[model samples]
Target: MASAEIGVIGLGVMGANLALNIADHGFDVAVYNRTEERTREFAAGAGELSSKIIPTGSLEEFVAAIRPPRPVIIMIKAGDPVDQQIAALKPLLENNDIIIDAGNANFRDTMRRFEELKDTGLTFIGMGVSGGEEGARFGPSIMVGGTEASWNRVSDVINAISAKFNDEPCAAWLGENGAGHFVKTIHNGIEYADMQMIAEIYGIMRDGMDMKAPEMAGVFDAWNSGPLDSFLVEITSKVLATGDDKTGKPLVDVILDAAGQKGTGRWSAIESQQMAVPASAIEAAVGARSLSAMTGLRAEAEELLGRPDLGRFEVGGNAAALLEQALLAGKVAAYAQGFAVMAAASKEFGWNLPMPIIAKIWRAGCIIRSRFLDEISEAFTKTPDVANLVMTPEFSRIVKETDTALRTVVAEAVRKGLPVPALSSAVAYFDQLRRARGTANLIQAQRDFFGAHGFERIDGKGENHGPWNMGN
Candidate 1:
């Protein structure tokens, strides 16, 4: 009957929840899954909201149920499946119909898809949705990338379903083509670094200080009320506090140490390298995940080199306070590197990405939502043209204040043989960043000596060759 205002394809966990969210917002949503049984089940489970949901048996029915110039959200497994779905839907959709890919797609794929849909009267939006299963059902942060007109068409519904901070929606139109996905990738990369740093601190507490799970959970809970307040921190405390019913032990202690990654963090590191920007913290986090996955190799290495017996990890004073400050410093470095990479990408791609808006939208709905992001938003709003986030006055002050604590923590971790890759990388990054004159001059001279690659002289002599005495 074409009565449904919108259509959602692929009723997986995310898709089903998003559809329910849309229906809850007073929009008649038509939904379809590959299996007809799943679609029928979803409709049946809708209960009181069943009337607002139009369950379709086939693609034809799904397309027919939505009104003209429909906005269809395809939330399925990313990559080839998305292309296949889009190909199938193209034949059924009319001109001006919108196709939104709401998945964790690589920005490159998003750009290619946008290009493929050009001049066909169909609009393509690469939307980055964050906040997990519950967030999907209640509210999520939406990052939209497409033409302004296309964003305008779906803004109302998207805004209505997004998390809010101080009565403002967390959803926003970031830019054209792949901007949303690119930003999302960086978001994940920063997430990797944040999680890795937290894990490193937990490792220090467990192995270095011999702390128990419940005690550490109390510390994390206390930190949540302070500067470190965020979703991940809250969850860490909850996870630590939880007890395994079967084993009668803290659930986290019984869990495996290995971690899994899904490529976004690696992409962030690769793209930063491509742009010649240093995102070492993100890189270190990605590397840590890779290393974690190599459980057999790690066991072999640990066997070959016995675990360090160096006793109690000692900081100068107040271990908890020092760890908190160190974590904050590392977070600053990770976020600084992430934002710097995005700034470079924005220029390279001509996205004209609004940094302040990006930060603002991230404050409520996304996985990385925090009071810290609000500070970043305000900082960017004040100094929109800053070369880097750390260069801003507010961030500069934070860096200065936390510098000593970061140094002490990294040094103590290194001394005690605790692995703190992301945290240590932050120390190195800050050291290199603050250094006015670095040792690269020697490398330049060596290059000139071996390959005749000229070096720029400090005494106004541009591109001068170094005199190398080679006794042949």
Candidate 2:
């Protein structure tokens, strides 16, 4: 007789925590790792939940522990490792057994794996599991994409281990094959933009306004009680206020300025570009990270270019309020761009992604969880067909009200020679989108003149070529 309801492969932090979470929910979970020592360690450290978990020494034993039509959850590193694990497990699994990838694998790879495994009588699920170690141990925001029948088999366990918003589980079956990973990719892209914009505001507070880290932390704390309330902002406040135990200096002050990435943000930007969607804020955020990585080049450039006298510039007394408003506006733009990319991809790929459901799931356990998402969820719930988020009444009003503040912040950043690419890009995107007659007509004419690319007329239909009088 099969001993466990589900089996988890990989005993890394995420995988171990997730397996323990399943056991905590009263499900019998079988755990395995490449190294048997890690599995032994996890089983030994499982505390009260130890009895519910079975530690397996081999892949075959792990497979044998689970019930028929077994669900094997893979939580290994993305890319080649995931493929390797799948190949190793395929022979051990019986027909109708399910393979669920709960890593950050690319959507295309997920789709390919789904196709490759279909004939072998195994169901493949690309699941995007977010909310770090703590969330994994308690509850996470789960985005799953696979066949309906396959989802039905695993939905109960997934729902039990997911965060809840208004009594509804944060886990949802997004669509077929790759939709889960694709949505997760976009989530990270939005996260990039959100973080960059916050950093830009913090830069203004630190450099332009000459505020101390603790003072800035206080401001962030205040914002968390209002419209800006979110996981990132809340943690940012704590990070800024934290002091180094040895030196008694603000922890953030002692930390390095260099940022690191794991490619999800870059992938989102690339997807947006390929789909012809304007995700300028997300692109700018990715560019900012790339620029941050070149520390030596920046140091050399600063020496060569000569540092400007930033002391001469003075930001106004309402800088904090201005920053809050500006950040809100930039955030709206960033989310709008992310959603637009998703909409375009949905149409292209026939995913039929539910915008409201996406927003709802993101409200609790995800990194980018915020009160603003609650508003967004409501907007989509009311008008599911809204092409752009900014086109919705609530978002439009927020953007319009915050428009002047955004302009002021960007103008001040430019005047003080402070880099605010994400903020500035958001402003530019908003202006361009709102413009009735853009300069694209001139670009079209230039294209027509140089490459014989026909231009569309304003009044008439069809592409028309311009007659250039060139001296022969």
Candidate 3:
């Protein structure tokens, strides 16, 4: 008898929580892990949900437990490990069995895997599951990419286990092959930009204003009740409020400044560059992380260059309000860049991504979820082909009103000799986009003089060249 509705491989935190979520939603799930001890431990602690969970000792047992046209969800390390799992399952799966890869996989690899499994008559889906362990055990924002036929086979279960926005499932079939992962990569890239902007404002408040952590936490708590309301903002408040248990110091202060990344953010920036989209804010965020990793070099450089005296500066009254506005502006810039990248990718890949749907799905159960996204969804819904989010009436008004505050924050950081790359880049990008004509004509003239790169004339139709006299 076919027992489990689906089988989940790997008993890692995400996999375990997801299996439980499936079972909790009234679907029997068979789970397997490479180590039997871990599998046994999970089974032992499953409690009441244990009745709906089938703990299999081997891959064969796990495969056998599911019905024909079996749906297998793989949650493991991406790249080679994903390929290894697929190879292991190929022989076990019959025609039309579904294999969903739920990891932060590069889209190219997903496309290759999709092709590899096409001949075997098995369906391959590259899905992006956002939100962490808690969201997985409750509901996650699911982005799935596969054939419509394959999606039909498991859509019910997928939808049932995904977060909802206005009673609609947060999951959707973004496109075929790698579209889901591609969008997810962009999601993470935007997350990096957003976090960097917040950190920049925090630096201004802490170093320039000398504000205490609890005071900053109070400001963030207040922002949570306004347009900045989001998971990240809410958590920022908590993180600021929390103190180190050992020394009673602010936890963030005690923690190391170094940050780590898993490559998706870099990939998104690279893709945007390749597509010729100006995601300068995202690039700046990634560059800031890279620079942060050079702690030894930075310390040595600081010693050699001497530190700028910031003691005279005091970010006084209205600093919190100024920071709030700057954050909102930076967020608008970062999201505009992300959406632009996606728009270009959709056209390049023939994905026809639904921007409004993407915004709607991201409203909850994702790292960057915000009330701002609700406004973004409405903008797209009102005009699907809006050139940029900043140009949208709702966002434009906010940006217009907040521009002064953003400029004020950046100027203060500059005078204090603090690095505010993400926020500064956002302002630069906004200025560049808003300008009708730029100084780039001189660049074209320079290129034409040296390399005969050919420059287009504004007054005429054809490419024109200038005759340069070499001083002899």
Candidate 4:
């Protein structure tokens, strides 16, 4: 099986798992790693496909082991090391060979590499893989970007190992050149927003209603059956139910209230700003993570910002009831933000990334997958240019009825002077859209004030760009 004869570099958590997944799919794979032992250990234990996995201690051996016109996937980190690895491997690869960089590469870098490799008679694809480590091993959402001409030469092999959504592989030769990484970059951006929104809901339960994590987790579990259901909610339920690993105490309190982020979150925020996507939730999350890394600074702030009292939520009412209701409302808000980002990305990339296709792909193959994704798929298929997620009647209704309770939750928490960025952002977005007045214009005014930048004036007659009134 030419499609199955392959080599994988970098046996870190993601690489190792993916190699094993490929082997499990009955592929002949030669696995290599910077350190020999990990590769040996993983290959040695291979069960049904034990013979299929060939562990190579030497990089040369790994290169020689593959058949001619070899297909190799570099799962290493992006940047210099990638070029370094390719330089070492290039001499070993034959003409008409293919190289797949299945890393979270910067799109521009991907484009540069594409140009560099063309003269060598080699095919290079920058593929974006989502679903993290687990996704890598089991099934993953994959996006490929390269020449359409080469896709016929390589697409079958690439798709074979990718996760399926609605029985279609979550694999597409996204478009020419840098498109793969571009899609993946935006995917991570969406993920950042989604995770932060979930984090916000948990905060509301803990600080606003004073409900516990396990209690909140249960609410998420129930929500998994509804229109708002998703993998995030399901995992949240597990997290809430889980107790402290050390002392067997409820784990929620022990977990630092702060969040952490890799660079992808920041990339999304930056890209959104560049593309003018108005990615507030993602920006807020990235900011939240930046704040998280400063643990001591946050600790010091505790003296200035005390906890909120939402005892009434838990005192008389059932915690699960309150949380489930609130989460349904919150998910709607989060998905709305995600859709908005995707819409903005479509405009930026000219991909016209069908939201229905995106939602369908996520249903089974992504971290954000859930029953709710189905509704999202339907919404987008019905209306491709959905302005915002909550604009859908179903979602709008949830926000409408639940906003009162969520607002009370937000207000009560703010009374205690706690910083709930995600929750506040969601609520603010809700109010901003529902209200006749939009503060974005106020923001434009402030920018024009300092930078002498132009602003869109909402004059009594109509909206138009009015020059900055710096003269006054």
Candidate 5:
């Protein structure tokens, strides 16, 4: 009967919730999972929402359930699975039927898929869905990358099912082909840095100050009222306050120290490096995760080198306040680097990515959502073409105000032998960025001396290379 307004493939955590969200918004959503049992189970569990959910057992049934010029969301694992799904769906879908890849896909893959489907008349959207399971069940920040026509066709449903900030929908067509996924990659990279920095601060509080989890939770809860009011901070407080069921200790203490990551953070770092934008904080965070996974190696190293016992951690004033400011400062640096990478990517891809709109949508329904993003929206709105985000007046003031705190925090952490790679990288990034003339001249000279690669003469001299003696 083609009664469903949209169709969702895959019944994973994200896909199921997204389908429910669509159905909750008064739209009939046809759903299909590779395993028919899961699809039936989802429908049975939907309860009241089941009326709006069309459970299809096969791809043909799923395709037949949707209306003409269908908008089908492929919410499955990325890479080859996505390609395989597309190949399977091609013969079934008609011209103008939209296929949306709502996965954590690499932008390069998105671009390649777009190229492959250009002549097929099947509109492809590389979408980036943010916020976790809860957000997916309610609403998420949706980033769509596709043709304007395709976006226009689906904007109603997309807008209806997206999170709102002050009555504004947190969904937008960022750019063509891979733009949405690219932004999402950088978003995750920033998330990595944000989380790592927070952990570093918690390490200081725990190991240095010998503070308990509940006490730290109180401080984090307090910070949530201030500039650090974000989803991550709010959750951090909750996680710290939670007690373990078995041992009655803080839940965090009983948990493993290691962390796992998908490829998005690494992609962000790789893309930033390829674009010649220094995202040291993001890189450091990635490296830290890799190191964390080496549990045996870390344990062996600890046994051999011994934990640093350099005495009580000291700051001139309130350590908590200093840590807060330092966190804020590190966040600014990480965000600046992320935005700079996006800026470079935009140029390289000719996406003309809207900086303010990106910040605007991120203000809600995303992991990194915060009061600071609202400020970022304003800054970018005022100075759209600024060389870097840190150069904006609002962020510039923040960096300056928090500079001393960040310096003190990093200095103390280093002295106490606390691992603060991400935070320390933020400091080095800021220092290197602010320097008018860096030591790169010596690097150029060294390169020229070794390979005769040539260097630019500062005073407009004739020869570019140094006349180093070959005999020496």
Candidate 6:
């Protein structure tokens, strides 16, 4: 017997697709939107003979359409509207009914709402759905957080509807309380970093070697033969050859340098800072985006700025190939920064989120899904307690072997006056580790001069002391 008497609210692109997907799986689905016309249209259109997709005009009718203990999935915007929807649905749904918020919501808010609704005996699940509108209709990556009882109640529907990444559905029990939203939050952060990495590759190609889109696309395609193979890279090839919309211009030269960001990108940056994890690559990329969006100022800067000139690449030569390889290296570092942020958050929140499961979840449908995810998935499955993504042996080997070329790439980019934010940040991370400077020891010297702090002696002679005189 199929227990998929699921109802979906907010039939925007996401909700509409999700409803169709569930119906395709033989679930008796009842969908409701704010408008009657749309509700009627989609039902008439997608509710073919193969599937049953009922539509309702209002909340009462939508509620009435489903049976008791309904597993209603909410796909609307987060915050006040969600609260309002719950209030409206409260009058109709029986106690112990499970409400799943499949929208991208803040974890704290989910926790608060769960407690608020607990008294009514209605279960609230804060689920993070990724893979965009397409994934929602087919299968999307889904991260869930709530009480065990609430999660178990809704697990069957979620698993059946969610798209598969690798061999598993894009779903997991993230943790207790606010863990689901938190994990989703980090997932978005990783996505931001990954996208920015591909953009940096384009910039390096365009600036360092003056490669066009098609030319660079070919190189990216070639790179995709190996570890650098990725969804973003594959798409970059299409975006390049597709050209610009109005002018039929090669998109490389036609598109504006300006980039726009949604709230989640900014949120990820903010949260990483709060958690004290070095999300430098993503942060730098965000900064680069903000600067790019200031078009007028950027245009003025372009006029004022002189292009940097580079004579040659002597570090094993082959500047062109080296630039491409370095871009790949930066891609690795950007992912590292993102994983670091996630790891720190996981530790802070006590989520114990499985990295391999997450990597598998992202391998197919999400924006960050890439060939690299397979490697990560393997590493974490073997060693679930990985301290960082970069520490994995294969990843470390790739990085260490190519570091010289990677450094050369960043140097050339700096010389060419290109904005390779993620790339530059990536190289800086590698350099920070390569040279083990005792910055903390130097800090102690400064602290001793100002605050009379004690210092350790290296020579085994000098009293192990600071509070020495501060000379003008």
User: For residues 13-46, could you state the per-residue lDDT of candidate 4 as single tens digits?
Assistant: 8888888878877778888998898887887767
Error of 2 at 368 (Å): 0.4
Stronger candidate by TM-score (5 vs 6)? 5
Q: What's the best-to-worst order under lDDT?
A: 5, 1, 2, 3, 6, 4
Q: For this target, which candidate reaches the highest TM-score against the unseen true structure?
A: 5
Q: Quick one: how many clashes does candidate 3 have?
A: 0
TM-score of structure candidate 4: 0.85
Native-structure RMSD, model 1:
1.1
Candidate 1: tens digits of C-alpha lDDT, residues 284-367:
999999999999999998999888888789996699999999999999999999999999999998899999988988888788
Tens-digit lDDT string for candidate 2 (1-472):
6889999998899999999999999999999999999999999999999999999999988999999899999999999999999999988989999999999889999999999998998899999998999889989999999898999999999999998888889889988999999999999999999999999989888887788899999999999999999999999999999999978999999887889999999999999999999999999999999999999998999999986655633546777788899999999999999999999988988889989999999998888999999899899889899989999999999999999999988987898888899999999999999999989999999999889999889899998998864774
Itemize residue pairs with steric clashes in candidate 3: none
Cα RMSD of all models vs. native, in order, equals 1.1, 1.1, 1.3, 3.7, 0.9, 3.3
lDDT of 6 by residue, 1-472 (tens): 3233888998889998888888877788888887789888888788362257777788877877787677788989888999999888888888888788888887778889888888897888888888888888888888888878778877777788887754678788877767777777777776677677677767766755567788887877777676677777777777777778788778767777788876667777888899887777778777877888899987787689855566432445565567567766777777777777777877887777777777777787677777887888887787677776778887888788778777776776677666677777888787775576646788877877787776777666553556376463
lDDT of 5 by residue, 1-472 (tens): 8999899999999999999999999999999999999999999999999899999989999999999889999999999999999999999999999999999999999999998998998999999999988878898998999999999988999999999999999999999999999999999999999999999999999988899999999999999999999999999999999999999999999999999999999999999999999999999999999999999999999999899998778997788999999999999998999999999999999999998999989989999999999898899899989999899999999999999999999999899988899999999988999999999999999998889898888889666877796678
Off by over 4 Å in 6: 1-4, 47-51, 306-320, 434-437, 444-472
TM-score of 3: 0.97
Error of 1 at 183 (Å): 0.7
lDDT of each: 0.93, 0.92, 0.91, 0.74, 0.94, 0.77
Where does the lowest 10-residue lDDT sum fall in candidate 3?
A: 309-318
Give me the overall lDDT of model 4: 0.74
Number of clashing pairs per prediction, in order: 0, 0, 0, 0, 0, 3
